[model samples]
Target: MDPFFLYVYRKLKRKCTKELPSCSLCVRLGKTCDYDGAASEMNVDQQVLLDRIRELERQLEAGSGGGTIAEISAFPRQGSSLVNPTYTIHRQGFASNLYFLDPESFGPAGVPATELDPGMPVPEQVRFILGNRAEVETVTESYYDTIDRWFPIVSRKRLVARLTTFEPKTDASVALLLLCMKLVTQILPHDENPRTGLYWICHQFLMQVEGAPLLSLTLLQATALMAIYEIGHGIWPAAILTVGNAVRLGHIMGLHDRDNAHQLFRANSTLTGREEERRTWWGVVVLDRIVTMGTYDGSILTADVRNHELLPCTDSDWDSGNIAPFGHAFASDLTGIQIGHWAQVCQAAHALGCVQRHRVDEGHAKNSRLDEAQQLDRTLVSLAASLLADMKQRGDMAINDPKQTGSRSSVDAIALCCSARFLLYELYACNDGKSNISRVSSFPSGQEAVMQRISLQGINECVNIMHQIALRLLEPQQHSTRQSPESYITYHAGSIFVTHALYWAASECSWIVKEGINAAAARVMGDLVKALHLLNDRWHRAGDYIKLLEREETLSD
Candidate 1:
């Protein structure tokens, strides 16, 4: 056995296991395999050939030196076991033969010549393929903020524009608007005043659209209803003022063009059905009433006095009082609850005024209005308690109602329920010695017991109603093949209302539970947030669909 051969054999076996053959020139050239046959076969200078051969020999000697041939035989050449171990091929019509080693001579099948180096898990060669962390973060944050800020404004604008014009409704603009409103309401706290600019813009658009004058009724009523909410909590006096001005404008327009107004109203009334029309008509009347109460001093009192006479109720009705009519008509499901709640609030206000007058007459106070105002505050607390109970009962029924359409009416119902809940909180605060009146809790020791006896389970029930409504609205509706534009608009608007109700429920959860009762408020809030995100995503997809449709139309044109 030759020592040099043994060393070479050992080196070959080691290379088969854990290394790959390296050519210095090829390595320097940054190429994988060397052109060994090309160098050998090419006609070149003898010196160059000898130099290459010497270099190869020198590398071999360095790799394997001073080992015996017997030891080499023991060293295991990679291809020693095979019967036909080598293959020969002729080079270019010449009898020169080339020998090749079999790939299996190396290691097990599919094993690489060398293992990956653990020190550098991510190699410098492929490091650049990974993205920049900071850039990714920056882009993500910017993308989210852009969506958060711009989407609401854009959606609202589109909604106002669509509603202003009678477009063949597809579930695009209205759905987008509802989703935006829902998100905004959910993320923003209740006490944080909502921007009136959007509402004002919508109102202005509705006013300008020339058609059936009553076409604006829904929008107007929605605005006024929101205003009532703000006024109830003593937030956004400007909104109250704006609503008052708008009502005045509506009155002026309706009065001067009586025939046209009457004709349009009649037509709209006929279209929407007697109940909805009456609800809307009374909504206008209520808006007017609210404006009068908010703006003109003694106007609310006088109006109440007149309404009391014009639409008189039996004493039993007021006292049987399990739940007061609150207003004249309690037929239609839409406005019945609303009218009831508003009337109760107004009645409470009137009672407070009376109490103030009585105090002044007894010479107990110089500012008689102040005393009456205090009493009114107490009445508000009581009224809120009663309404809370009624709402709870109604909400429970709504949840259990087998025939509930889960439509826009349902959304409105949830909205009213939430509104009632908030009013209860406000009234509770007012009666807690925080605002207008002396603390009802401190009045008589028994008063606390009486007030505490007021059922708050209704708040929980209302929360549940809101939760269910939110779920229903967020659910996609199966559209009819020939659904009307108005129906589409109505559906979208209802979705928005549903989303808003959920948002309200979520936002109010902490406050709702702060009174020491764990209700569905928190769960409802979570559900609403999830539903809103879903609805927003859907709206964006719908918008893209509309764009595609428009593009197709343009191409057709």
Candidate 2:
């Protein structure tokens, strides 16, 4: 978008001409005109769009009287009250954000704080929140600052605004959304935290809300948040189940299909809604693919969505609600395209899906599998190079810019690259005696040696990156008594997002150490073991990695 027009629309309180070759202002100023930004409707009257949406929604609710949700399919049918709830699109600027409010710190570790009654009535839950408004605001703020910073699925500004109103009580979906955020952000060190008591409360509420006839955007967002919480806390089949719920909901809502969303909205929806759906879908994709990595388990994601979806806007554009239209970017349109950190992560997740679903497994020729694997290897190499280079250039991972979505830790997006590389090479890691693709010990030939060399390079880079992260996370000569793994993730206590990537790298490292003696690989493994040990108390996946690494260490002995 034109900076002048954005300022004029946002600050000067004027309508935007939205001219293509520069607005009249730019033409008069004799500036090179460009209007490369968010939806054309953005600079227009947002209230008008909201009013239209509200009217359409009212019509929808009126058409469908009332019904109960069945089989988790909340789609509306003829004469059914199961409508899609559209919360007021968050276009009210930074007032949507509560940064100006006095943020009282509300960590879960403390007692003698405002607490919620577990048996509070469904509608009465909002009262608990209103009574403890400061605490609610603090935890929501913490979510944006830590967990949401790197893997932002929902808008903190929108949630903050929703919390201040009656929406939570009126909308069961909104209530579930708030519960999921509080569950994730507040319940740390799960054993002793009083908020852990709310886990079952939240889960039960989710079960009831999931069956609601009205499938609100807030419901989908809630499921996604709950999935993140379960995944991060290493909650077993619950994590898998929650991820499936979110992914299936995203698919049912046609979030993966840009044209489908357009059809549903029918010309009145703005980029704000599209961007929200985009981020929510990508968040589910990241979770879905990451969970299924290195496992035979199939992905809940349906047909490849590369050609059908638009990647999220840049971090700054997304935060300020300056999101461009779908024409700005499509997944297929972005090859080696440097857009934003999360966009790159989306691309990486796509690569992972490609690796898992590669043609190698089909009853094709060995040469076909080999050729496709090489292509995948090149894709990952290019991807890892782009992400690592940008991360190195960008410098700090603390995210000093206030315009930034949230303060992210170092492992925000880069770890997925390592994971993709390791996964791509895992099938080829078998002995050359058994397979022609791998030539680690046996004599090398033309194409096989070249592929082997590339595979080893990718493998080594995984260790190199993991070693760098472990070193960055663990200070030199610092007292190593780490009862808290969250603090060990970054220089400070940043939320953990990529422990699965760490586990994958450790598996590859263990294979390396078990197969032969690589001094550098072994040293990296040591750093990883120390880091994993700290993380074990928090994430079950990390603890598993520690055991796997130790078993490899024993074999090396």
Candidate 3:
């Protein structure tokens, strides 16, 4: 009956049958019937770790006099089981560090094992539904061919390397990731979409893995892929919840600290796992912003990316498994910088966060935020310069590959950047705000009108940008060679990851049609909707996007 203990149980996701002394579940597990006693013992070891972390922090602060410069050394990373973990942290110069998450203490998992396959040769049920070994190989290859090129969250070579050491019956994390890859890549019937089949299997494994105290990069990648399924299918609330947990894991593992001054040159200065970690964090950030795009809500990426948060490593080097870091950070000066495709996507998502942040700003009137908007627009323009140039030379579909629209492998990044600018412009210009737009002006005159007029111009430019992207998506692919061949990937239109960009543009332009601002923009929305219809076969959420636009069209009519 003690609510505190009940809350703890709920936080740990244990269902208490309300049995006296110990809940039925606890009774079955032979644990103390909690709530009425010193139930804190349930997580006493976790507290010990926390207390040790605090002590370490205090010692670090006292030693470094509050400096954030970490002493770079060849110590083992957190979570490794060591009889004695060593960190040569004390150095000749300034030195200190903050442990976002200390490694898990050495112990078997508190919960039971969740065997995904449950057999040496893979269970008949799993093998029948998912596939046999060779079929699984095809599905896995398709995953890399389809989503991974754009999302680039999971490392294929790394996963193959890791799976080589994993036992088939065990290794739930890898299993979950593989299942998710199949769920997204393989075309299952509607009954097998979410709860009825593969999605359900992955969800159960995710719950088990997410519960067992939750520490593992493999699980993080697994969650991201599953959440992609959720977002792609328009599975609300659940999508956001999944992305939120992934963000939390990202923060806990210090994935967001890649370029942080405190975490620099750490991880033994070898890019061993750092490349995957860096790419995963960017994927996490992009997904966090993307889920909110469906509702035109604020981005969920709470981690403030600094100007120095280096963008993802070069695409070419990453694919070849080279460990060289990218040339430049998202450093404030983004002028004429030649970055990779995925880096552009990362920056676009980061800027979308900034654009969405404007909606939640309550300090000043919307008009007062014009300077912020202007600066953001300028930064976005600088980023889009190369993309626009590429589009100019090569028309809409840059490469012969259908999935790559704007400028080959950079299609999703181009889409995201266009949506960012479109939403930023529509934030001030569009009359409708509740649905597609982020905000509507309460005070609709004078300086507000001036801002709206300026936003209208920006919106037009965004429309022009959207037109090019739409043409790339809507127009048939040409067998031309004006642009270099994209041998790196060959993603078809059916494999585009998130339709957030296409959805966002259509939503805004639909309102532009309703308001009679630019009737020509209607064509652009139609083109985007057509593309979404083509993609609906793959994601199904594209259908949701089309339905929303149709509703608007109906209401306007």
Candidate 4:
């Protein structure tokens, strides 16, 4: 693209004889050449392009040789815009900014001043987190059975081993235990306010051991779990901080550097230990992508980390009581059926990030962007196809099977598939810029009609899937029941999923209404409202959706 600009600049600068009021070149080409004050701005744009082109050429030349590329860095630092800055694309004619990767800060970090004032000993903290022996057994069982599948970083066997020892007061161990108990005590179907006290103590413990001298695998695991717990509770700022810390610690320990385990950790590290670290690192990436959805919070796991290794093993492989050496990449012998839903979620996230990076580098110029979006759409479709095929091959996890429907991981994989499709829709549909509710203003006839068609298809699929998810949320056996707190972290990604789809539908309601799709739009809205209402009983934030619908109704009235 830069080279093309340079070529145009060179052609424009060439001296040509004038014929009448126009330049000679214009006359020879039978075209108009009315250069005015705008020519100076064109020259400035050309100069910027030339500089960028030269830098890229230098990087290319270095890559051709033995040296590394000068432009691309393996590990970008925290808050570095170059890592992956949020790109804002203006709607061709609308007032709202179309953001691809907008940064989201949850505000200031730390617990209440008074809350941090008092510090209890590890023994008291342990007892506070777990009241009695029976309570300890219950919390442990609950976490392993219900919550662990989503982010299986902590080893149940290892944790049980630690518990058997006398008062193991490590920061990571304590943080992990506190967070698990907090989730169990808070998210279960009940109206108990007693556990918030335990949640605060856990927060205090995390703050106390935050700046410990040495970094351990356990600490990273704890930090990742803390982020997950905080995000589930709608504590965005704290979740952001903990996830950031976890990613930073991961980089320092070279967790993402492939095949460098011995160099970073103990020389005698077992295969199981190495595999555990890999899963934990990937878990952080999953949480990072999940929590940062819809906002421009730059992802903690950069492309560099993703390229470093293969995904973790299947649940069956991990659960089997066999010890074997794991490879640096996904095993070719393992069929797609063996890959877990969590791995599919990671792939979806990675694909979304790639699309975002492409958008940032290349502005929303219709021609190439449509092609790229379609290509990404194909890739995402292929991923979904693979997941479906895998599910069929397994037989037990059939798409419509009642048992599979209850599995949180299965639900998450399907939701993420919907998310990827919506991303494709948003990429192309954003530029239409028509916001008036009275007319079908976007994707007017004859302008990139192919893109408009693809985007419309994406929208249709997204809305349909949203309706399915809403129905699933009403199921009696879903993890987040009417009586339980909304555990958005586990299987309840529907909260964010529905909100995103609902906003997209509502924003375009005027256009759809004008196009005689009012009935469909109303149905989508009704389903979303029903799902959110189910959550509203226990999750305070769910009420926000109800209020949004009310405002829309008022506007209509």
Candidate 5:
């Protein structure tokens, strides 16, 4: 036996006070565990473990015992340190310090994790991950940039008139309506310039389309539900603006128009079948009316205070039985990108409303319709919470499913990243009394403490999810030579989403909760920014490649 092996064996023997064998790495690493292997293999493992242990020990000594190895290795498993001291195994003869571990080895039960193959060069593997992330970021940036650049140029008046000419059959009319809404919403926020008048003209043109059928109950319900979330977060201004537009459109189409508009609005209201949808729509309409009423009285929306629960989801009799279930027109799987818009709107509302909760039915005149709005708000919040929970559960199951043994699809990969970001926001935004309620009430000390706990939990989850995503994107899989460009694009987009989500979350925390985020979150944001810059460089390079390919084909022809 090698002398080192003999020394480790003696140490293990001394540590083994019972019949069960002791782990060599634990003994050498100065932790506790079980070891079952040849002495040389054990020695090799111990040396690796010892290197890490020594590094940690030095860190602890430098920090005057304030820093611990336990803190460094806190993730992937915390309490189980005694049983699974090292959850990962680095590839044999690989000089780099990267470790490959089964995703299942880390975290709470049922949380998702990604597995990495052991053969690839660690540096190349990391680059591969970064490349995918870069691609996603590039695509997202392009999408935003395109929207920003072309929006000012789009002729809203002509577009609205064009929209009016097409009286579509079936449920497609909602698409046109939504398009009109999108144009207005995007332009309305920046309407100070002279060019904004064109948007108003366009808005007027769309409003001229009488009896425009409310198509896609799913979309209306989704939008309404999102509005409720905003109201709950005390982002009354945006909630008012968005829902007010919907109400104005509904009323204009319902009451003022000469062409069967009232019948169409009635039909649309009746079509929403889900109890949740009915509640959300009613809540939005009632709230819109209340806000309008208050504005008419020259009072703030928050000035009125009544019990919101009086208006329950069941208050509406609008024949919700007629609404169809979600269909092919709506995207399946609820991509994070799609849901992201709703989250953004909700956050924007929160910022405008001073992060306060309000009583739903207080101070409204008789038949004020505020009760319906409150019910809708509650229902939408419940729906969002449920959706988030389901996504988390599904992600965990998908990761562990025996049949899902192959690499993840680009969509699924991106979805996972989005889901993680969603959870992070929930951690900061959801259930925080200070952030959730209206300004009339101050958060108690206990509530503040709870909010901090929730933020910490969310931060921990976000960091872990980010790590898993990074590993999956960067690390090589079996039988694949290099990651596809699509993978790069997806990863890049996902990283951008994560970066923006963090920035928004941090900003919200600083503004509402006053609980400063730790340095790690800031560090992660910095890394993501650097990653974006790198990705932009890659995108430019890829653009060159594409142009070269096109020119080559042209020359060949």
Candidate 6:
């Protein structure tokens, strides 16, 4: 056959085998034909290459199985020191230099430890665990720069001093430092797994310190940080457990008893140290209540008189290198950014917790749930008036002031004030569709009826203020600007409660909408969607809510 004819014949034969209708030659001459086999051989060659690559990977894994941790640490980026000796890891090869990991770190369960003096610092004892210095420092700096502002659990000066100057490694401090780093990685962009190996290590360390002979102030703070970590990661059950443990630990350390704290101050402790102890206890209490807000349950801290101490003094006073004046009374004259807002939040929590306790009461108490709710409402009203008064006092100068813009804490305080009021309304008005109190039309008889009217009105005001704050928070300056995850989460914490109220208003309290109320259900829902969309990037929960609203829309359609 001619060369061109032969090539054409082969191409036609291949096409005929792949497609259906027989080739012209086969149809005309009634012939059976064979196709070229080169494609089959090529596929075989590719498969062989892939198999070889996988085999080599398996072999490499097998070869590394026998290497000691110290030898493995010798490999580039294979090791991380414990960073604190008191938090001893029972494993080796944890501190890899990688910034992003795919699946899992070789945790304590899987790895063998390198022999070292048990009393040595973790950084000196373990060779290859944790992470590199630069990565660790980045996470540490990111945390202090962001989350620490709201919580103020760690003192900046003290943390800086610890990082700069060498100090004896303590389990509690190291656990807290590790948690701060973990939180930063979670909030910032590292794109690692949600539960990182670093988190597991910190968790392990915290577990080890659970029953130590003496639980220090630092230890209680560390426990609280762990709860924040769990909250940020969406681990509610674990967060609740951690918060409960922290509260108990605080009591064990005598943090709740002012007398015990005073004794500590008498025994060579600085006034600042005692204040920090006080602040940590309050931080634990506030978080305990905040995390479990909508469940209508009281916090573990309880409404006991002893549990309520003076709110923490100014952050400046707590962070001071020298002893500063400590006032147990609520300081009304302090700036919004000062410890005053923190006090307001704490007191508001106390009041709300009181209401929840009353609601859950079994009628064994002298006062009815309605009576106690009214009283706590009064208490919260007083506190909110103080916060608003402070704002009013600073209103003229504060309008264009950077403090209003930059003070996330103040924004949070105002939002909490609204939430406290909103929650009190819910306590009386939320019927759960099965109660005698019809939230829709009728109110309780007489005094209860009057209070319900006031609470309903209060709900309107609270929702309106909440809407304005949400708008301000979701404004271009706040949302568009790059920020840490903590900022968005903290902001959303306040707004989520508002969203809950709007949900109730739109569904059950449609009469509020019918009456042309200040916080119209439809209007607030629209604003909430816009605000949540803006926050969708930093907080996934906002996006989740948006999806929920959309789904509800779809279902209605």
State TM-scores per candidate: 0.34, 0.68, 0.69, 0.64, 0.30, 0.65
Span of 10 residues, lowest total lDDT, candidate 5: 74-83
Give a tens-digit lDDT track for model 5, residues 1-557. Answer: 32223433555576433234655555554554534432444554565566566757665676554322122321111111112212122333221112113322322221111122111111111122123434434533443333212111122232234345533332233333333333322211111331232223222322222212122232343344334333322244665675655555434322222233222222232223233333333334334432332231222232221222112211112212232343112211233432322222222222212112222223444223223323323333433344434434445223222122121122222332333333323423343345423321243445534544544555455443443333333333323354543334322323212333333333322322223445454444333333333322322222222233335442121
**What residue pairs clash in candidate 2, if any at all?**
1-36, 1-37, 38-323, 38-324
Best by TM-score: 3
- For residues 85-136, could you state the per-residue lDDT of candidate 4 as single tens digits? 1111112311111111221221122122222212222333344445555666
- lDDT value, residue 101 of candidate 3: 32
Say which candidate scores most in lDDT: 3
- Please estimate how well model 1 matches the true structure, expressed as its whole-model Cα lDDT: 0.35
lDDT of 2 by residue, 2-42 (tens): 22233334543533476875688644432334356444443
lDDT of 3 by residue, 1-557 (tens): 22223333554686556576557686443344546544455464564455456547655776755454343211112321111212222222211111223222212121112211122122223333444567667878888777766777777778778766855544545666777787776553333444434565556556654543335677789888888888877777889999999988877555776443233123533474777877788888988877786455555665657877777777677777786744467775665666667787787788778877875665776656776777777877776766666544545355343334432355676677777777677667755556333444565567557666777777667666655665665554344443422221135422344366677667767777877888687777777777676566566677777777677663243
Per-prediction backbone clash count: 10, 4, 3, 4, 30, 14
> What is candidate 1's lDDT per residue for 1-557, written digit by digit as tens?
22224433554452111125865544542233433333334343443444455545545775554332111101112222111111111122111011013322322222121111111111111112112444323433432233212111122222334445522222222222232232223222223434433333333323322111222333333444444334332345554564565455344224212233322122322212332333333344443433332121223212223332212122223223222333353221222234333233333333433432332243443243334434444544455445445545545224343223322132433354354343333333345565533433345444433333342444455566567655554444333443432233233323322333454455455555455456655565555555555444323222222233335442121
Q: What is the lDDT of candidate 6?
A: 0.51
Pairs of colliding residues, candidate 1? 1-68, 1-69, 1-70, 2-68, 2-69, 3-67, 3-68, 6-72, 352-376, 356-372
What is the Cα-based TM-score of model 3? 0.69
Alpha-carbon runs more than 4 Å astray in model 6: 1-137, 165-172, 188-193, 211-214, 260-268, 297-299, 302-308, 319-323, 330-339, 364-368, 392-404, 430-433, 436-444, 477-520, 541-557
TM-score of 4: 0.64
